[model samples]
Target: MQSFGTSARVGYDSSAFYDRKIYAEPEEVEDGSSEENAVPELNRLYAHSSSSMHELPDNSVHLMVTSPPYNVGKDYDEDMSVEEYRRFLTEVWEETYRVLVHGGRACINVANVGRRPYLPLSAFITADMIDVGFLMRGQIIWNKQASAGSSCAWGSWRSPSNPVLRDVHEYILVFSKGDFARQKPECEQKQATIGRDNFLEWTKSVWEFAAESA
Candidate 1:
């Protein structure tokens, strides 16, 4: 397992690998919107994000945004059945719920996968998280037209017997722990810096963005 920093770029547009968003003002974190401040120390681990998050104190985290390994032959994930993968995420979600502050939100990015028989990985994971006590909130579809599968990936092309559709999107699932009406203490310290254009675009369930290259 590896460990590393956790801060992603906030404000404006940049071609950085991480996603862009407007953040609330920093309390424990350095104001990343400004260029003057040095990079702040972030609480993040490189190991399996869910597995390593157990190290954090209970009710300490207000939000968690992560794109976990899809386990579709990723270097870090061992070969496992879909059922096994579901069990693994159960443990991860258990830990996630334990560490989250009441009403804290967890944003998970994942997608359905296919080789021969298509697997609805996102649906199963969503059910697992709900079973672990998380309340389902919303889903954002990330439409990556540029990253659409190539012709070679189409199993049988136009042949109706074994036609395969292109995999061109992913889902960001949002869930909250405990009462949704619970007040977050951090709201007082941080302010939303989102602009009108961004707010309009981001509020939509379907989003179009370029995928980060490896």
Candidate 2:
């Protein structure tokens, strides 16, 4: 799950994304809901957020997988350059590392972002997380087989000097917080199972278990 403090920006006129009075009261989060309603489900409706991305208690989370807002069209995410956006994500990963148990895993699903298609956003994030103490395990592609992206038509131009193809696939990065060993004897055997074994060579990075709406 993601955490928000009073630092987020929410536009008042956009009801489709945020309300006008968010962060105006004594709230538990930046969203303006009261402190009394502080709960996981109520995170979006609260105010006065104090959650920090880097100071969480250690070993509190077992497994965390989230698709965070890309800070693109979303109103809650203010527009920023790609480099600035990367820095924000790095901070979030730092917090994830602090909160995760030794054997915990965090999966991040991020589609590449580009005004020009030359930028490889997913690769940069994976590298940045490794720089900050998280172990980069591997990458998986979430292929939306029949679905099309907005820039697909432009990409279909086979010209060498043309813009890159529209991305119909997204990447899911798998990372580990710390060096891991099973806490229980039975769990060690489970790690050797085919599903848990990430070392197998025949595994494909491309996966097709989802939809464009995801």
Candidate 3:
């Protein structure tokens, strides 16, 4: 398995990719009523919890996106055994399934680790999610444009005897609770529309992007 550095550094400047405004302006209110023009307050919770989520209600969440610990001796992972790691993830997923709505979606971003044994973390998580009663909705490949120079292990280096393949991408596994389609009211449907450029690009299975600098 590979180890990561703990030092903090300046991250890559990705503002160029996000500066464009793709969303169209909201329609002007014909009646000009205060309520029609009012923007709803967005209540957000930003907290960190490794285990049970007591704050959230059962079947209340519409979507969940998470990038859990990889159990690869990271500073935050506490060096858990493989079985212990699996159990920990299972518990978290069970809690996630309980809090999701009937047709809510869960997206998990994960990458494989190790070169000798080749631990497929994403596949293991997929099985665990299925065991927790989540329907698999396929996955997206996030090509993070990994640099070969970053990896220290090259096996035989230049020889074909044992060449290690560099992992340049990660998996974004998607799952739905109970049903494939999420149920929404007519009023909320308008808010769910995707931008034209985003719709075309996001629909593809492969997403090419740069990795965040440390």
Best by lDDT: 3
In candidate 2 the C-alpha lDDT for residue 52 amounts to 54
Off by over 4 Å in 1: 1-49, 52-54, 152-155, 186-190
TM-score of 3: 0.74
**Model with the higher lDDT, candidate 1 or 2:** 1
lDDT by candidate, in order shown: 0.72, 0.63, 0.75
TM-score of candidate 2 to 2 decimals: 0.61
Which is the better candidate, 1 or 2, if ranked by TM-score? 1
lDDT of 3 at 124: 94
Worst 10 residues of 2 by lDDT: 29-38
Error of 2 at 167 (Å): 1.3
TM-score of each: 0.72, 0.61, 0.74
lDDT of 3 by residue, 1-214 (tens): 2223424554555444445464243222121111111112237564767368776766667788999889877677778877888998999899988777677789999999997799999999999998787888899999887432465464556767777888889999999887766657556666546788999899889988777763
Ranking of all predicted structures according to lDDT, beginning with the best and ending with the worst = 3, 1, 2
Cα-based RMSD of candidate 3: 15.7
Candidate 2 lDDT over 1-214, as tens digits, reads 2233334664333343333466343321121211121123322432422225323345656677877668777767878787887887777787776667665688899887765445677888888877777766689988886665445555546667754566678889988765533253343455455554554543777776547453
| Per-residue alpha-carbon lDDT of candidate 1 for residues 1-214, written as tens digits (9 for 90 to 100) | 1223436534543334233344232212211221111222365455545665645666667687877777888778889888888887788888887777777789999988886788888899888987787878889999998776466464576788866677789999998877554463553656779999999998899999889885
Candidate 1, residue 56: the lDDT equals 69
RMSD of each: 14.1, 18.3, 15.7
| Candidate 3: stretches off by over 4 Å | 1-50, 146-154, 191-193
